[model samples]
Target: MNPYQAPLKDMQFLLENVFDANTTWQNMPAMAEMVDMDTAVAILDEASKISRDLIQPINRNGDEQEVRHEGSKVITPDGFKEAYQQFSDGGWVGLCGEPDFGGMGMPKMLGVLVDEMNYSACNSFTLYSSLTAGAALCINAHATEELKEKYLPNLYSGQWSGAMDMTEPQAGSDLRNIRTKAEPQEDGSYLISGSKIFITGGDHDLTENVIHLVLAKLPNSNGISLFLVPKISVNDDGTLGEPNGVSVGSIEHKMGLKASATCVMNYDNAQGYLVGRVDRGLVCMFTMMNYERLAIGIQGLGSAQGAYQMAADYAKERVQGVAAGGSPTGAAADPIIVHGDVRRMLLTIKSITDAGRALSVFTGKQLDLAKHGEGDVQTKAAKYVGLLTPVSKAFLTDRGLDATIMAQQVFGGHGYIRETGIEQFVRDTRIAQIYEGTNGIQAIDFLGRKVTGDNLATLSQFVAEITAELNELQHVSAEDKSAISTRFDNLLSIASHINDNKLTQPALINASAVDFLDAFGYILYGYYSLLLADKAVGHDDANFTEQKSYVAKFYMEKVLPKADFHLAQVSRGDSAIMDMPAELF
Candidate 1:
């Protein structure tokens, strides 16, 4: 089979038509000169070519070869080193990073474009760079001038790589329980002694050094503090020194993403420099994690797109059945794509994937607006970024897993095999739902922190904004418009239900958080689908518009119904769950 093709047509549609990203950037002073429509197009085109031609070929090879941990070092599959060198040399690692630190300083909207392609082309290969970029972003945010000067350039240049050392055996997600220790030294540096599990790219052969952003507590600290520990120490003159008491215990033999190194990292009194203020480690760690959360969502979307392409291609060529009415002419069997059920599966994946693309890009645009937009625009952008982060992270990955499974079904028995690659997509994509934050936790964060804590201010305003956009739109079918309107109202009603009953009903929010998240996500995807359809109803690109219109209909008719079911669950409240006795079973 041919390598996955980047969906440039749909990407361009979202960038240029639906989002009007060019004008969005033109409004922002920071991006006007550097990233016009012309520049954005060229960048995407170049990035897509590299992803398809250079990176995709290694995906299958890496999966089969996996990563090997020998003695002190870990080894990646053959050609990974060369592929990474090509990536770093192209300056793609810093595509959206700081310019002062040797980065390109492009917009995050563009990062969504380039990253989606990279993940689709080869997710295992992409994880290495993804971790590196996440590490650089945290260090840039929390590190002092001296540390930033010392490390950011090398990270951006890809001469060095990076990792995050969190998730100790005892303190999975509960930071309050961490036992890792950081003892102070006279010179201000500390000796960090701890073990961190599930450290992605914790040790690799792709770079000269691995900079680990570790989380540990000081002797008398109230909470965890972050530290920067390098695998290979650095001298005052910026030269490489001896090992920093770090070692790889073992690499995981996993169900998927076998190509990416997931190491058991042991830091034995390793020398580490503090990143942020004392006991503010959660703040520093979250800065990197928030960035990673969105990237993880994009991973889901990418894997879905990859799986869809494979299944669609396979369905077209594999002939297995006669048409519903009769055999066409004298042909023995018709291609599976002719069947309505197969079409349903294909469209289910396509509709969700397309809407997912729009959702991801829209969230990225909010980040750009938050940074570069002035006054209220910036405030509103920041609000959406915070509100939608968990939704985007959870919704995309959950649907990504669903999409891959659906794609696998399209292949029937063939999908279960290892060599067909569809199963690999299923396996590789599984990690997204579990990592960054579990989908269940994301929902709790969405409802508890974002909704009830703020009293649904952003969610309310977003509902109003989309309702107004729907009012102004033309040429959309009334049925489609009504479906969107009714579902959104149902969403608000659910919110109101929680608000009204919660004072008398204390456990309502926690009990209903997951359903609320699912309901909100379904509504949000429906929102984006409507926007896409509004633009596509009568566009210059006939075929493209037709495809968008079709997907838009499918989403509203078929997918949005799921929203109602989740809302029904929300309406049921904690009564059913709470009524069950602990000893009943």
Candidate 2:
């Protein structure tokens, strides 16, 4: 297996040229005091090392060893404990956490890139830390000041880890079906009782304690609420006390991410604190859920990147039948990369992954503006964040899986065998499309709520912004610019068609949801690819700049056409899909 090298050059280019993180940071009052381009570069450099040297080395071994379930305790695989210690000790867990609680307080734009590096190294190993960071965000946002003071510091510092316990045997994407119960107690706490399944980082030895953000309903109330439950009790002085009622029923043996503990957690009268107001737990959970959705998308992106590196390197070295144009090296057989089919697959992965990275950074910038900017800048940014969040999750993971499968094809028979490690990428990435709210659900949310629910107002605003930016670019060719503009217009037309007819044809949005999201994704990728190329003009590194232009052109010519096909499907409406009765199957 080829070593996973963080795509640092492309990352730096996107930050400095495409998105201009320096200008963004300088403008935001909250971030200007904390980061500059040089500081961000240094941080990324260290993250790359930690990912390459520490976490990645244990990836294969961790998968083979898997997490052990002995009695009620779950034990992580070998080297996981050590690697997590170093990762936490360096404040990597709190890289983008609150500054008041001993966090580094970096921008999400920079954090998303760093996350890609760590996830690319090892998915299983990174889950423990990722969950912790997410839980801290939820607590910081909605928890009481006392709760924040006590839990935020440790959760951010990585001394303790966090888990999101939302799913049960009955409830997955639908949180309304949750059966967990929270009863009020005299000490201003609630006693939580429930069994939650598929809890990632639910129980692990990597941290001294596990803090769970659980969803449960109060007695006699149908409305759900959020609670903070810890594995071990904490005394007034903040020292560890006796074991709480929280216990791991068992660990799930999964298809991939084997080293990460996915436990079936059972809570029996566990003492818990409410996070946010009553009957509003779902709102609070969204704070963390939205963040996790994007992170999972990056998980898919990182896996595709790792698979591409291995496949591309293999194609160059693995000798196969002679190329149609003859071997460049003049040998009995040429490397597989000399074949046109292999070149197509590799280029497809490259073009999609590059644009996907740009999209992630763009979405991250919106999240930063929403959090730190004031007035209309903040309001508009929040709207964009809501609109882009689902797209970022669904589209990126959907493409991520496609890219991995294509990269595996480059390896041929070697890909199927476990030793080559390309198979792992496929298996690991499959979950990203399934978990964090399945891609199908994400599509519905995008089209049904985010787009049609607003009567296409938000979608129009986003499209107009992209169009304005594309019109301003001077380096891109007029033909390429026209292609992008045409698609933008086509997209709005389809959105309008759906919006106008959705009232009469109730199933229009639901049936057309996936196709609409897919078309939107391809169009957005096209826009970002051209934007990247436009930004790369007159760079000091001629080779890098030229490659960006070439990839952008290829994506425009080959991949952008995918939008038309999906749009055609959307035009078909729900007839073919909904006409078939469920009982027929």
Indicate which candidate wins on lDDT: 2
Report lDDT (Cα) of residue 478, candidate 2.
Answer: 85
lDDT of 2 by residue, 496-583 (tens): 9999999999998889999999999999999999998888888889998898998898899889999999999998889999999999
What does candidate 1's lDDT look like per residue over 1-585, in tens digits? 767789988888889888898899889877887788788898999999999988999999899999999988899999999999999999988888888899888888879989999999888889888888889999999899999989899999899999988887787767687778999999999999988889899999999899999999889876889999999999988889999999999998998998899999999999999999989999988878767888999999999999999999999988998989977765889889988888999998998889889888988999888878999999999888888899889999999999999999999999999878899999999999988778888988888777766777888898889878887778577777777788888888788778777788887887898889998888878878878878886677798788878888888888888988899999988988777888995
Score residue 325 of candidate 2 by CA lDDT. Answer: 73
The lDDT of model 1 is 0.88
Please give the TM-score that candidate 2 achieves against the real structure: 0.99
Per-residue lDDT of 270 in model 2? 97
TM-score of each model, paired residue for residue: 0.97, 0.99
Q: Pick by TM-score: which candidate is best?
A: 2
Q: Where does model 1 exceed 4 Å of error?
A: 503-506, 583-585
- Candidate 1 versus truth, CA RMSD in Å, comes to 1.4
